[model samples]
Every structure is written in structure tokens, then in C-alpha cells.
Target: MYSGQSIAITGAGGGIGRAMAEKFLAQGAKVAISDINTELVEKTAAEIGATAFTCDVASEEAITAFIQGAEAANGPVDVFVSNAGVGFPDEPGGHAAGGSNESWELSWQINVMSSVYASRALIPGWKKRGQEGVKGRFVIVASAAGLLAQVYSGSYTTTKHAAVGFAEYMAIMHKADGIKVHCVCPQYVKTNMTKGMTEIKEGPGKHLEASDVADSLFAAIEKDEFLVLPHPVIKDYFQAKAADPDNYIGGMAYRAKTIDKGHIPLQ
Candidate 1:
């Protein structure tokens, strides 16, 4: 389904973004990948046969510039993946909202508004294409934290919820405009964001490689699905969350007590 189409992804210097870019390239798509790290993105592009653009997704101007550059290099984008993300642990405080204002602000910019800015830039053209029967896809690499919680990171959890909410908003408001939205909510993936985190080996949850996450996305696309869950168990958890809010809260309360054991982010 991806052959000869233009695919653009953010945070493609490594991890899930890079894996997604590789998958698109293998499917005969002309891919454009971007990251805030210029050297790293350029190197990844050279190695993976994708066009490179350095973009700080936190900035609206930078995002638009990246889009224009990608279109110039590989035609109009058929799929735009807002895969770039960041995580910030809560500060050492007694309350749940311990993260600094700067951390919360940065988290909001990167995790939520980045997707909004990209959608604002792409939806106009996508609507025109949709009217002609060609639809465009928008993918957001959110976290299971959005549906549940990230324990130590209030900023990460809150902004991810916003990210997921934005995806829903786009799906509801712009589906008629030829916009297809997919929200990816994975539990724990082996990415730089999860570096040095102990891998889960037992139970319903497990650590996944970045490529595994990309494969899940392809599967969702094939099935014409909206929610791309790399970790299937997340769906069960989400359903349970909706089923019983009290038990879910108590369970998370207990999990928070031990999150530092192996769930603490290295960075």
C-alpha cells in the first residue's frame, strides 16, 4: 500500500522513528526523516536511504520548514508520522504534580502541540486530496501512559494524554477531510527514552524492540485500524481501567511505590 508514496517521520535519528522510516523505505516509499539532532539524523538518512531534515518539533516554524523541505525532496507527503517524543520525571516533591514548569511546558510542546502543528500544516492539502478520493494518514506515537499512567513522570503522562486526545480530535473533526488518524500506545519499547530501564520479562507486559513497534503500525494500517497497540495487553488494561476506576487507581498507587525499582528513566 505504501509503494512510491512519500512518508515523513519525526525523531528519526534512532529508535522507533528510524524503524518506521526503514519499514516505509522497504515498502518502496520515498521517506523523509527529521530530528533535532542534525548529525544523527543526517547519518541515519545516509545509512537508510532517506532524505534528512533537522527539525525541532517544538517549534511551529521549524516543523513547517521540515514539511516544505520533505515535499521538495519527495513530493507531497502521503503519511506524516509525529513520532518524536520526550519524557521527564517528576521532581522530588510530596505531590503528583512535582515536575517543574519548564519540564511540563517542554513536554506539552513536544508531545502534544508538535502533532497539532503538523496536522494544521498538512490537513489543508490532505483535504483537497481527500475530495479527489486520495486520503492521507496521520500517525502519533503516544504511550500506554496516556491511557494509564507513567508513574514517576507527571509531565510525560499528562502531555501524552493530551497527545492521545489530539489524535481523537483529529479523527473526529477531520475524517471527512480525507484524514486518517492512528494513535500508537505501547507499554514499554526499547528506545532511548527507555534507556537503562530494566526489561520486563514476565507477566502480560514485556519490553519490545523499536522494530516490533513499527511492525505493529504496519499491521494496523493493513487492517485499517485507528489505535495501533504494539503491546496487545494495553487494550485489556485500558478496558479494565474503564471498567473499574477504583481498582485501577489502587493498582497504580501500589505500582507508583515501586516504580523506582526498574521503571525509572535513565535520562
Candidate 2:
């Protein structure tokens, strides 16, 4: 479906980002894949036959360089995926703890500001072309934790929520300009991000392969959908929460208590 298109993806060294690169390449798109880790980026690019760049998405200057480099390597980017993110150690008092500051800052920079930096770099050029009715796709790989919440990490949850909101704002404001903005929200995908975490077989979640999430993403792109829910259960959970915030909070509190029994450090 993506034949002959030029695509750029951040955090493409492993996990969902790598899966996305593989998927797009399989569909015959020219792909430029990047990661903060130079070795992983080079390895994944070699493996997938994609152009590689080592980029720190947390830095706006680095993001601009990556985008410019990708466009130079391939062509005008048809799709740009802001998929880089970080999960930090949990804070017992959320943002109130002293140690939480570092995690919070990192989470905000990577999980949230990365999307903004990508948008800032893309939107102006997109608008110039979009005014002529040309289409450009911006994909943000946010987490389902944005819609509900991550019980273990306050920084993660807060930044993901910001990511979702920013994507929505872009979609609403720029759709008429022929810019397609999408947010992919998935839960429990098997990725480096979820390494060392125990899988929950029951409850409001289930684990999925990174490729499964990639498949959902491609499907959403095909449909030009704004919100991509790789785990359909997340939609149900989101609706339930929207329908009754108090009830949702009560249930989440119970789950949090159950998951964090003994109130020990979960890192």
C-alpha cells in the first residue's frame, strides 16, 4: 500500500520502530530509520535495507537534521513517524519526590517534546505543499496509557497524555490543509520498552507482538484514521473511562493497589 513512498521513522533501531521500518520496507517504501544508538540504527538499517541515521529526538536541532538528512537520502517524506519514547523509574509520590525530577524531565523531553519537535520540523513544509492540496502523514506512536493511565509511572502517563493531546491538536488544526496526523495508541506491545516487566494475563490488558502493532498502524494509515488503537480493548476501556470518570478512577485505584502491593520500589 505504501509503494514508492518515502518514510522516516524515529527510534527505529528496535521494537515497534524497527517493526514499522520493516513493514514499510516490505510494502516498497523508501525508508530512513534512526535511533539515538548509532550501532543499533546502523544494524537495523543494514538488516532492513533502510537508510540509517543516529538522532537524538529529544533535541530539536537533532530532529531537524534527521528530517533534512532523510529527505536528502530518499525524497520528500510522505510519512514521518515520531515513535521514540522513554519510560522512567516510578516515583512513590509521583512528581513530588526529589529523584522524580530527572525522570520527569527526561520523559517530558523524549515522550512529549519529541513529537512537538517533529511537528515543528514537518508542519511548515507540509503546509506549503498542503496548501496546494498535497498530503503528508505525521504519525505519533503514543501509548494507550495516554488514554487510560500507567499505574506504575507518573512521568510516563503524563507525557503520553500530552503526546496524544498534541497529536489531536495538530489533526484538528491542520486537516483542512491536507496534513494527516495520526496517533497510534497500543497497550502491552512486546518491545524493548516493556523488557523486564511481567506480563499480565488477565485484567484490562494483553500483550501483543510489535509486528501486530505495526500491522494495525498500516491499516490505520490505509483508512486515513486519526486514532489507531492496536489493542481494540483499549477503545472499550477508553469509552468506559470517558463515560464515568469517578468509577474509572475507583477501579484504577484498586488495580494500582493490587499491582503495587507492599508499596515497594517497582523498578
Candidate 3:
């Protein structure tokens, strides 16, 4: 579905964003790549012959301008990937329960509201063009944490859940208009965000690469699947949780405690 189409990807400077940008370019798509890091975005854009834009996804004005800039450069965007995010490690004094309002607000802005801002700016154009059914795609990179709470990162978990929910709503509201929405839920990937997590042991096929996730996303887009789970185990986990919520939460808590055994808390 993405062949020779124009696509816009936020957070295209690093990790999953960069991986997706490379994969799309490889698939013969004209890509408009945006990131807060202008230098990296420009470098990647130059490398792949993509149009680059510098814009913080958290800023509504920036997102709007980016949409206009991308359209000016490569016509109306056929696919929009909302993938920018940040992580805050768990802190002492119950970080997951009720801590760090600032962190929560920032997470909400980038992880959750960025999708909203992008959809708002682009959906109107999509409606006017009446191009919903003809290979249009909106892909949001949510997380496995969206399906299940992360032990230490309350804000990340909450916002990821919101991102997935928003994607569902968009799909429901715009399906008749031909817009396709997809949410990607991936487990722990080896990225700068999880660089220091010694406890996260790499099991067989456990740690997915960013490029792996990106490839799954592209496949999902072609299939028009709403949920793109790079880590297929997550779908099983999700079903198990849905079948028995309390038991699932209990099991996760037990596993977390086991993982933290004998470790000194970060000072």
C-alpha cells in the first residue's frame, strides 16, 4: 500500500523513527522526515534523499507547520507516522503511583498529544481530498505498556495507553471516509531509552530491533490491520490479561519483585 506514496514521520532522527524512515525509502516512498534534532534529521534526509523538517511534535504550531512544509515539498502526505516519545526511569517514593507531575505532563504532550496534533492538522486535508480509502494510513507507535502497565514508569504507561485509545477512535471515526489507522505495540527494544537496564535480560527473540518493528508496521499498513504488534507475544499477554485482569496484574507484580531482588535502588 505504501509503494511510491508520500509519507511523513515524526521523530525520524533516531531509533525506531530512523529505522522506519529507512525502510519506507527502501520501499520507494517519498518521505518527509521530521525531528527535534535538525542536524540528525537533515543528515538522515540527505542520506536517504528524503525531505527533512525540524519540528518538536509536542508543539501544535510546529506540527502544523511541519504538515504544510511536507505537503509543499512532496504533495499531500499519504501516510503519517506519529512516533516521538520520551522515557522517565522509575524513581523512589512511589514514582509509578503519584510522582513527578512535570514528567507526566511532558509524557502526555509527546506520547499522547503529538498524535492528536498531527491528526488534527492532516485529517482536514484528508477529508477535503476525499482520499481516505485509497491507501491512506495513520500509524501510531504505541508500546506494550499501553496494553499492560510498566512497573516503574507510570507516565509512560498512561500516555501510551492514551495513544492507543486515540488511534482506535480515529480508526472508528474515519473508516467510512477511507482513513486507515494502526497502533504499533512493541516490547523492550535495544535503544538509547533502555540503555542501562541490566535487569532486562535478552531472551530468545525477546528484544526486538527498531527495524524489525518498522517492518512489521509496514506490513500491517498493507494489510490495513489496526493493531501492529511487533512482539507477537504481547498479543497473547494482552489476551491473558483480558481473560483475568487481577491474576495478570498479580503475576506481573511477582515478576517485578523477583527481578529487583538483591539490587540496590538507584541513589
lDDT for each candidate structure: 0.91, 0.86, 0.83
Tell me which of candidates 1 and 2 scores higher on TM-score: 1
lDDT ranking from best candidate downward: 1, 2, 3
Among all windows of ten consecutive residues in candidate 1, which has the lowest summed lDDT? 258-267
The model with the greatest lDDT is 1
Poorest stretch of ten by lDDT in candidate 2: 258-267
In Å, residue 249's CA in model 3 sits off its true spot by: 1.2
| Candidate rank order under TM-score | 1, 2, 3
Which lDDT tens digits does candidate 2 get at residues 78-106? 89999998876575555424346787898
| Model 3 CA deviation exceeding 4 Å by range | 93-95, 130-132, 199-205, 260-267
lDDT digits (tens) for residues 19-39 of candidate 3: 998998888888999999999
* Cα RMSD to the true fold for all candidates: 1.3, 2.5, 2.7
Candidate 1 on 1-267: residue-level lDDT in tens? 799999999999999999999999999999999999999999999999999999999999999999999999999999999999999887765478877899899999999999999998999888877336448899999999889988888888899999999999899998777678999998888888888888886766888889999999999988978999998989999999999999999999998886655677626
- Where does the lowest 10-residue lDDT sum fall in candidate 3? 258-267
User: Which clashing pairs does model 2 show?
Assistant: none
The all-Cα superposition gives candidate 2 an RMSD in Å to the true structure of 2.5
